[model samples]
Target: MKIIAKNKVAYYDYEILETFEAGISLMGWEVKSIRANKVNLKNSFAYFKDLELYWSNAHISLYMAVKGDEQRTRKLLMHKSELKKIHFKKTTNRLTLIPLSLYWKQGKIKLELALAKGKTKYDKRQSEKAKEEKRKIEKMLKNYS
Candidate 1:
């Protein structure tokens, strides 16, 4: 799969519990924009409305040759069973659904959705410390080699 865009901050701010692949409903212009890598997954989230899933805040810039809304809420297409499962987990665990990445699959655009819990400040700090330690270890090994 060729990944087009990702929400880099999502991993830093949330602990992912589960992941799901979803089909995004996009207009022709929006799809073109995505092919040009004019998409941003930041601040984008999925929500359930009337038992259906919709993504909000994901920005797909208008194509240079086409005119359309850049911030429209897009519907996510998934099986009914999957939707119910996500809803159950979300309500019971108080988790959130975040858009992790957008990618191409079988010539169609698909979204990677993650069920996650927000991290606390201490958790963030610990993650940062662990990352720094890993970097130091890699650097030490490089020098030894």
Candidate 2:
């Protein structure tokens, strides 16, 4: 898959439990802008509205001569069963849905979304420390070989 945009902050701030693929409804201009790599997934998330899913805070830079909101809410296409499943988790498990990445698959734009739980400040610090230790270990192993 060719990735157009990624939300790295989502990974750092949440503990992912499950992931799923989703299709996005987009305008022609928005598609063109995305092809040019003028998309941002930062702070973007998916929410439910009357049993349907909508994407918010994602930005697609306007194509020249196209006037519209760059961060307008967009609809996400998914199966009813999957939607119901996600909603169940959301309501009972208190998990949130977050966009992990935007990419192209089979010539169509696809969204990789994760069901996650928010991490505490301590969790963030522990992850950072673990990463640093892993990096140091990898470096030492490389030098030893």
Candidate 3:
């Protein structure tokens, strides 16, 4: 799989519980723009409406010649059974669906979405502390060896 773009802030702000892959509905020009490396997934999220899924806030830069909204909502294609299960999990657990990454899978563009819970400020600080401790341990081990 060739990775296109990743949502860096999502990892920092949310704790991921699960991940799902879904195809994206895109126009020809939008696909071309993505291929040209003009896509951004940093602030994108997915939502359920009419029992179907839609993604918004993901920016696919306009193809030079076309005039349209860069962050317009786009449909996400997934199996009906999976959609129902995801919707149930999201509602019951009070989780959110965030797009983690975009990549090419067997010639089709697919989105990797995470079912995540927003982290509190303290949680972020604790995680940062843990990372720092791990880094220190690794450095000490390297120096001793």
Task: Find the candidate with the highest TM-score and give its number.
Answer: 3
Q: Which ten residues in a row have the lowest lDDT in candidate 1?
A: 61-70
Please list all clashing residue pairs in model 2, or write none if there are none: none
Model 3 worst lDDT run, 10 consecutive residues: 36-45
What would the TM-score be for candidate 1 when compared with the true structure?
0.95
- Regions of model 3 farther than 4 Å from truth: none
Per-residue lDDT tens digits for candidate 1, residues 17-104, read 9999999988989988899999999999999999899999999998876777789999999999999999999999999999999999
TM-score of each: 0.95, 0.97, 0.98
Give the per-residue lDDT digits (tens) of candidate 3, residues 1-145.
9999999999899999999999999999999998998999987899999999999999999998899999999999999999999999999999999999999999999999999999999999999999999999999999999
Off by over 4 Å in 1: none
lDDT, residue 24, model 1: 90
Candidate 2 accuracy as TM-score: 0.97
Looking at candidate 2, the ten consecutive residues that score lowest on lDDT are 3-12
Candidate order by lDDT, decreasing, is: 3, 1, 2
lDDT of 2 by residue, 1-145 (tens): 8998888999899999999999999999999999999999988899999999999999899999999999999999999999999999898998899999999999999999999999999999999999999999999999999
